[model samples]
Target: MTRESSNPKPSPNDKIYGITNIKSYVPLLLDLDRLNYDSWKELFKTHYIGYKWLYGTLTQSVLQSILKPNATAADVWKTIEDLFHENKETEAMELDDELRSITIGDSTVMEYCTRIKSISDLLANIGSPVLERNLVIYAINGLSHKFTHVVTTIRHQKPFPTFLEMRSMLTLEERSMAKDHSRHVQASHQDNASSPTILTTEYQNRPSHYRLNNTRGRGGGRNQRGGSRGGQNGGRGGVR
Candidate 1:
């Protein structure tokens, strides 16, 4: 009966004003334990400027806990923040314990250091970043006994090297140790090649043909000597 309003409300399907299929935009489901909060927050913040559309990205459990029919985006986001941020201290402690116990065991130096860096990154993500000095110390502590000398050298430096520098020094030291081991093995082989004891062992280990030929030669000599003695005895008997 009345004239239509000048500015009608935009439909939910309006291209610029509406968000369709939030799951397509933000694929990650928010978990209760907050392990993925940082990543989930970044994606959610990027896709939608509005908060109402966030419910679809949460797990059913998280959704039931945070959802209310009258709740606004800010309310839900604050609830999420409270749930995730409150446990940062506990998470940091657990991560610190993990970093402390990491070891180099059969892993190469690169792999060992990469593991330390990964844990450090996770700590940083949780707002409990490890200092560079402490990171280096953690890495050095985890090394196997073979790196003891390098570890001592690293600790003794006036200004401790960066983790990368320390890793480089250790890599070089490992190469040097390998080279020295190779040289020692070669020298041992040379020494064994020239040693009388080793040569005797080698002689005894020679093929059966070589031993058999030598034994045949010795047997011939003994037989010839016995024949000479028998001929001499025959001559003596004739003289008698």
Candidate 2:
């Protein structure tokens, strides 16, 4: 007892002795759905160097998934890494599918292009950036049927347009379509204004035969008036 050394070895469980729940110390939770693994990892890196501390930061589902009997901290850490790695692939594919499935219905050209660019940016964050050319194609593919001509022009161009160029071209095409539609509406209105205004009730109630006979009667009356005026002029000339 008198030969005890001044320096003593620390117990293996020294780090975990006072810790009851690891999660209470951590400020945030790890959520796969929100894609916050990066933040969760950064916060977790500060605490205990091993994976056991991660059990506190993780959600119940994540904790349950990595839990194993007699599993070491290293084993748990590897499992977490593997799960996130697999998740990245699955997320990338799902994002790519979302990109391909987008449509430009009821959205302006700028809005549609911005939406696509946003998705591409997200993909890049996940280490799966979409090629610029493919992005252009994706934007073109999502345009409405009315933009078929613009899509064709973009596809046929040599040295395909950049994403910004494509967006500008689509915006111009949208304006052109809007102008054409406006002009067509104005022309339609003008035609309506110039046309005869038939009373709906009278038109619906009158028979075809009655309208025909009325038109003929009006023509006969005009002819009779002209004959009477002519005869009166001839009589005046004879007297002269």
- What TM-score do all the candidates reach, one by one? 0.59, 0.51
lDDT of each: 0.83, 0.81
lDDT of 1 at 75: 82
Alpha carbon deviation, residue 3, candidate 1 (Å)? 26
Error of 1 at 51 (Å): 9.2
177 in model 1: Cα distance from truth in Å?
Answer: 1.6
Task: Give candidate 2's root-mean-square deviation (CA, Å).
Answer: 9.6
Estimate, for each residue in 1-240, the C-alpha lDDT of model 2 and write its tens digit.
Answer: 344566566665675556667776677777555455655666666565566677778888788888898888889878877776676887889999999989999999998988898888767756788999999988888888999998999999988999999999999999999999999999998887732465776587889999999999999999999999999999999999
The per-residue C-alpha lDDT of model 2 at residue 121 equals 72
Candidate 2 TM-score, C-alpha based? 0.51
Candidate 1 is scored at a TM of 0.59
